[model samples]
Target: MTVINVNESNFKQQVLDADVPVLVDFWAEWCGPCRAMAPVLEDYANDHAGKVVIAKLNVDENPNLAGQYRITSIPALKLFSKGEVAAEVIGARPKAQLEKDLAGHVA
Candidate 1:
């Protein structure tokens, strides 16, 4: 699977209503770390495939979601399960570390 781009319009159906856990990466184009985390998320999306859904929501473009989720920084990763946020990672980190952080919810 590939990393999907989510926005205010599709966030409900894609992340909130997903049968599997969804990891939504809140990022912005001006953020260097966000840029660096892109490929890592893509790899994760491919590796996890059906186990989880990886999605990206641009903070710049979707300010409402950023505010709703309280995203104060770039590269904020939130794992959603059953329509609510289950876990969160606040920085750009390695895939192993990220997976470990969200291990409980991912599995």
Candidate 2:
């Protein structure tokens, strides 16, 4: 599946109201790491398809949502389950490591 582009308007429905867990990548176009993680996120979204929802929220475009989540950095990854944040990963990392870090939440 393709990664969803999340914004303030659809944030609630796409992530909060999702039946399955949601992995949200808080990113910005200007961030190098955020750009680097784009393909990784795409691959992960495809692999996890129905199991989890992968989304991208551009911080530059949605500062309110980013501030609400207390995102202090770009490429911040948050795993949300049951409408709440289950885990968070700051900065970019390898897919294996990212999966390992979110193993419990996704499983």
Candidate 3:
């Protein structure tokens, strides 16, 4: 529920300028894997709370942002810290696996 829906207009302020780490989910509406990853990200956002921020960007709606990040795939997770990408994750994954993948940055 805490996941903020980001678009080209606010991407800079929301993700790039965030005080805490921001996990931006680059996904599309028709992508099956992206849909599957939604709840996992939501759970992560809720659990992490103030430690990190979760943002969802629809590639279909904001192709500019997707292209800017070189998102060739759906469900691409880019962790932004201090205005730069700190980590990246691709494809759909279980919550535990996603957590493990981001452990270093999230912790």
Candidate 4:
């Protein structure tokens, strides 16, 4: 599964109302780390298909949503479970580390 592009229009339904845990990557086009993490996120989307929903919200385009989440940095990954944030990962990291960090939440 490819990472879904989320925006203000679909944030509620895609993340908040999702049946599975959702990992929302709050990023912007100009963020170098965000760009670097793109492939890592894609791999997780494909590897963890059906178990978790991976989505990306461009901070530049979804300022309101970013503000609501209090996202102070780019490439911020927030895991949502049962309509609320369950865990968060900031900055870029190796795929292995990311998976390890999210192990408890995703499982």
Pick the lDDT winner: 4
lDDT of each: 0.90, 0.90, 0.92, 0.93
Off by over 4 Å in 3: none
Candidate 1 stretches with Cα past 4 Å from truth are none
Sliding window of 10 residues with minimal summed lDDT for model 1:
98-107
> Model 2: how far is 7 from its true place, Å?
0.6
Which residue ranges in model 4 land beyond 4 Å of their true spot? none
User: Candidate 2's residue-wise lDDT over 3-104, tens digit each?
Assistant: 789999999999999999999999998899999998888888887888888889999999999999999987999999989999999999888988888887
What lDDT does candidate 3 reach at residue 36? 93
Query: Best TM-score goes to which candidate?
Result: 4
Could you give candidate 1's per-residue lDDT for residues 1-107 as a string of tens digits?
75789999999999999999999999998999999898888888888888999899999999999999999988999999999999999989988888788777765
**Candidate 3, position 60, lDDT:** 90
lDDT for model 4 comes to 0.93
State the lDDT of candidate 4 residue by residue for 57-84, as single tens digits.
Answer: 9999999999999999889999999999
Which stretches in model 2 have alpha-carbon errors above 4 Å?
none
Against the true structure, candidate 2 reaches a TM-score of 0.95
